[model samples]
Target: MINRRNMLRAGVVAAGVAGGVAVAAGPASAAASGKGWVSVLDHYRDAQGQERDDAGAIQAAINAATAMRPVHSVLVPPGEYVVNREILVSGLNDAVISGHGATLTLTGAAATTPGASAVLKITDSERFEVSGLTVVDNERTQPYNGVSIARSSRGTLNGVSVYGVKWTGLGVFDTTPGASTDIAIINCTAVGTRFGISTNGHDVRIIGNHVAMYWPSTAEAAAKGGVWSAPSDYYDGINVLTGSDRTTVTGNTITECGQAGVYTQDCTNLVVSANTVTGCQLRGIEVDGGSRVAVGVTVSGNTVVDCKGQINLVRARDVSVVGNRLANTSAARAASLIAVNVGSSHVSVVGNHATQAHPTFPAVYVIGDATDVTVAANEVVAGTPYQAPASVALLYRSAAGEFTVGGRLLATKGLGVGNAVAAATPGKVVSKIEVFSASGASLGFVPVYQSIA
Candidate 1:
């Protein structure tokens, strides 16, 4: 969150700027329109055609915005803009660039080149905005990143659509880690990219976006030796990683990503809630601690559907996965739908509903020396999209930790075992479910293998 002092500081822009015959002064169309505006056509009229590069004209419009006093907006209005070179918007204060009915097409020598491949970059600024733009690639043979925001603060991207990027569609970062604050990306659509949105800044909000087709095509995957993102495992739909603090990803419909739908790692205080995730090739939602283990993560109220691998928390701590709905989960790479593995601690998988589960594996699995994991009060239904036979158990904990499954269910028969429970409740794996004790003891018999469908 940016304070009042931060907002006031962002209002400072250098004065005494000018534009040429192709550009004009900005007009405040309404209360919603910005105080200052600069039209790119007023600066360079020949920039409208796709036959030539428009980077100079576009950059000039942005410069003119800052050159004007209290007029801080640039418009790439209602036309096609072809760019061969990268267009830069750098070192500004309190500015907006809107392109509601415009399209920016990138051509010639456009492909992923680490930090220099983005079509547009907003760097080293404060209180900046870019909204309502469409960015696409001209060459299907090669593509680059869509927009990159680096070392900026109090910035926003709203209602933007980006496609045909190979590396990252929308990326926000700071060279100095954790130095950025109060950035928001709202209602943006990213498609056909390796990573939809990758961020490592502070206090960022990624909300209400439609992101899909984030995996490489079959030919592209074969080109990488039958793997997805081999050199870099960053093909997720929305990635929050590395020094990101107070990040919130909510209310987005994410689909068909190669890695995970919403992936988080090496961050702090993340909240991934109310997102609909589906058709992911790997884990639907993964909180993997890649190097610097993420602390204070919460994944709640998301609907994960039919993903090959479901929600997994690997090497993370202080996490809560609650009130999530998982449906028709399929097992992939021998991992269950809900898995907490690899030395993860203080995790709670509580109050979740696993409906119509096709249990090729156990519905819930806590493995790999995980400690202090509680799988409680979950309603897990096996086999049957309400249709047929349900196989496998409700839970499996193969860890060396203190695990508890509260609410013992009612067994039809008294098949006594070493870790037997006095079956007293009714209606399936209800009240509580504990298949094995911490000391490798069986808690029940016949009903342990019984279908709760």
Candidate 2:
């Protein structure tokens, strides 16, 4: 087995007569002026009358390209290239390792460990393009991430199929403190992993990808930290964080994860729209911790069903959650509470619908030191058997917090008895109650106003 780091540093040559011809120009100046293509099969030959192409021989070819002119293409032709160790596809500048209808299938022989099976490990290469190939990492000891891209500027993973990887199909992480900018994933299929596309890059766009997660059992959920941790390696399903900015998660179907479908933490300027999330064990979407720290995010136009909780926003600021539908398609556990909780201020939860709340829980629960939270234009029509509306529609239990609820349809208590502010003292000023609901409502004039009058 070749040490990937040493092979990368030694500069592997592309295999074959065409590769040797290309290398005859010397790896350094082969295509310094124009473009070049390095094919993997060109390096393979019958070793001791064996029929299969040798993995080490292929690695030697890739090793020779280390100091080659910016690789215009690192082509892997259609065939099963069995690897004994992980392959590092590293270089700098607008390089492309295109598979051009080639199948870079990961063989089961490399099942030495979780880290040894990945077909391609991309690093520090900008404007990288990987497409039209099938990468399979068949390891059951742990989930194998298909392609790992890091610190690469403007990376693209398009029309790629990743099979039998554990944690994620496509993963981009900023292991270095330095920021990775402008990553895009389009038209990809990731199966048999915890998450399809897992990213932690700035200006990331995850569009038009079919991402499916493994159906986790209760034990798997707990071991993997719950359904909210879908794509369950560390934190699943596009875990973008650390002040990464401008992430758009749109038009993707994310289902059956251990945790939240879309986990955006500490991001500046984020948007989750036109995405359908279902059968997730935990919250459907979680936007956490971007106060003044990570500002300007919106979660809109999403349909989430059968999730433990629809949405959980904590310590976020300037967030607009509108035009979303939350429904419980499962009868086992109640749909978890939908909340904009703790340290979050100036949030607008309008034009959203929630159904099937827990008997004792409200559809939308607001907690923590949140102030100026607006709950308006929402419809909470309780589930069957009880037409009396969700617990109170909205619960504001934070001490010293101000909430404004209006333009909502409620079937139960308009101003829930225990949730109202205590009556004002003789000279102190108090917030007033306002009700704007349809006529013929039972709680039109709440039977009891639990105020300290």
Candidate 3:
């Protein structure tokens, strides 16, 4: 019988060797993985026993050391190592830079100034994993970004905390003059920044992160104010763009942001599931453009409360909104699910519950030039004169093609709008519009304008 403990140790040893480091044979090594391990304080020491505070030590240990192979890990001891200089980490293929129990803090004179520099910059690396460290960017006082991971593939940041970043907490950019893949962020937190985590990478996964975007005070805004930024628009969550594909945002809690929780643009094959967004000033989830059919976007099992707009899909295609609960705390006219200004086709909305407690509006809305969008299997209920007009549903001004509506309720004082099937080429044959009720009963429907009071 292969013991689970032994299997874990063996897996670590295999990873160590595959990463280009030799497996060390010892009882202590067996605990984590017997491999070439270097201590940040001891291995990269000066003439005296006291370790150097230079960022060069870290770079030398990972990038310049000839004896230390790839797939090696640098262990930082438990202490505050203030980095006054800019550090660049360059690695390739399965390199690990880990903090055992130490705090890697970026310290500089800019912490008292208005313009500093980025703390750590990573470039031209692949299969890199960073864990168990607090990377603080004092750009609030100094004015700079915290950490940037650029041109790296298969990069993973785990149990990391980044705060006080001026621009973005974690900025993953495509700067290699080419493209990279496979980025994952797990158990990370970012606070006090323009954007918590911003990325332009493909195959990305952001899981279990806490982001709080606080507005700069009126005094601070006046001191360091600019035309490009305002007291609003500060986001503490994730913003993704630049033609990103195959992205998954799961198990995250984002609160108190000025703009949005998760805003995605130019993305394809995306999934935003199992997240909690609260106290956002603008919207919760927003998706815009893509090349091919932007399909398979599942927004499921999320709790979105106290936001102006809950889920907004604009200029996107092939979307599935399933099993979500939204509540608007303010008296805004914005619907819980608003497909405004989107020209997408073939959208399926299922199993979503919204409280139109907000005054004078519909709980759900399907507007824009969206074609063949179906609003089925949903529970939308609200009071009289309540804005969320659809106790059950609404399909407004949609370029009609084909609709499959079943198992939904439109609960409002306003009359429900029917599907408007547009012609193929303005003169071509228009397709038929179908409707089904909450109990699967077929309701023979007509066009919105034709269906009267």
Candidate 4:
């Protein structure tokens, strides 16, 4: 068994070598065959002790461990180590870097490039695992990332805490499309960064993470005024960007971000489910396809509260937004609980509960040019209507066509007057169409034409 005392004694013996130099040990020195575990402190502590940069020692241990016929584990004991430069781990298969309550602090000049600026960069590796580590970059003036995994597949980053990064905290990126796959980022916490976690890989799972304080503002501004009152900047809790497909983001808590709590742009086959998002400056969850027509996205079983907009999908196809609880305590102005913008098709918004204190905007807003979209089984409660006519639950705007209400063709509109329904007079459109119970009491007004021309 490897305990602290034995490890410390071994480290003392390794430090006693002549010339006080760090050496990369061979396989013969390993404690076990085919399963080697190298302690960073035992083999690589600096001559000047904890006050000096021990990154070289850790890097040497990583290189030595990777050089073994079979890959091994690099154990980082509980201590504060400073790394002035990026630590690169490349081409290592089945390697594990396990930090047992270790904290790696980054200092000095920031690298101009993304790969160099990352505190720990892993490239061209497979089956790598990094867990139980705390990486901090407290220098706000410099751009840095906590971890960057590029061109790496089948990697797991678990139980890591990354904070105070100038740029993204954890980035899983690849140069080519679908180069990186099966990456799992689980139970991680990222705070006070510009972007919490950004991925450009396929089949990635971002589960049970807590991302917070991503708004770009000072503590004084947030304390005196609210987080929303500050000048907003672009930030996302978890961003699944282009080239990422079949990604899953579930059971995460994201709060106080400048942009969407969970955002997917130009990503296909994405799932954002069971997340708690609150106090976001922009939409809570957004699937935006910038002229590319993203397909097969699902946003379901999320709790979104106190956001500017709850859900927004733009130019996407074959999307499903279901079983989400959305609310806004503040008075509404122009945003809705759910907004399906133009060019989206084959969409389903079902079984959602939405409420707003001031009912200025519609609970669900479906814009023009969105085809094959269905909004059903949603319960919406709002206060008195503002400039709009009466309290209507659903608002839709489109060209004259056969419109369906409650799964039946209630009205067919003609092109004589742009707004005229076929069953109605030519120059005048149907307005304030209400749905009532069998008792003839008005349940509420269906979302008929409210100045939609």
Highest lDDT among the candidates is held by which one? 4
Give lDDT tens digits, candidate 4, residues 393-433: 23322225432233222223321111222334334455545
Q: Write the per-residue lDDT of candidate 1 for residues 122-197, one digit (tens) a residue.
A: 8877777777888886464444678878888888888889987667889887766677677888899998777899
lDDT of 2: 0.62
Residue-pair clash count for candidate 1 = 11
lDDT of 2 by residue, 1-453 (tens): 332222221233342121112222213222322335555544444446453354554454455444576544555544455554567767634545544344444555445454433557777777667766677666545445687778777778877888766556787776652266787887887765656676667778888777666556434556756434334453355566666778888988887766677887777788989888887767889888854444688889898887777888888889898989887755556654367776777787778877764554556767646666776666555443112222223432222455433224344533332233344544443433334333423342223333658
Worst 10 residues of 4 by lDDT: 12-21
Measured with C-alpha atoms, the lDDT of residue 424 in candidate 1 is: 54
Error of 4 at 57 (Å): 1.5
Q: How many backbone clashes does candidate 2 have?
A: 29
Which residue pairs does candidate 4 place in steric collision?
A: none
For all candidates in order, the CA lDDT equals 0.70, 0.62, 0.62, 0.72
Name the lDDT of candidate 1.
0.70
User: Where is model 2 more than 4 Å wrong at Cα?
Assistant: 1-35, 45-67, 100-118, 216-235, 290-294, 357-360, 383-453
Q: 1-453 in candidate 3: lDDT tens per residue?
A: 221112222122122321233334222232332345554433346557565544656555555322345445654434455666556676645655565344556666244232224566666777667666677655354555566677778777777778776677776767431265688888888887778887778888888888877543433444656211455436547877756778888999998676788888777788898899886767888776644345557788888886668888777777888888887756644555444335666677777876667666766666645676766656655542112222224332222454443324433543333444553443333543445554445476543332335
Question: What stretches of model 3 exceed 4 Å from their correct place?
Answer: 1-35, 43-52, 64-67, 109-118, 139-143, 176-178, 216-233, 290-296, 332-337, 383-453
Ten residues in sequence with the least summed lDDT for candidate 2: 17-26
RMSD of 1: 11.1
The TM-score leader among the candidates is 4
Per-prediction TM-score to the true structure, in the order listed? 0.74, 0.70, 0.72, 0.77
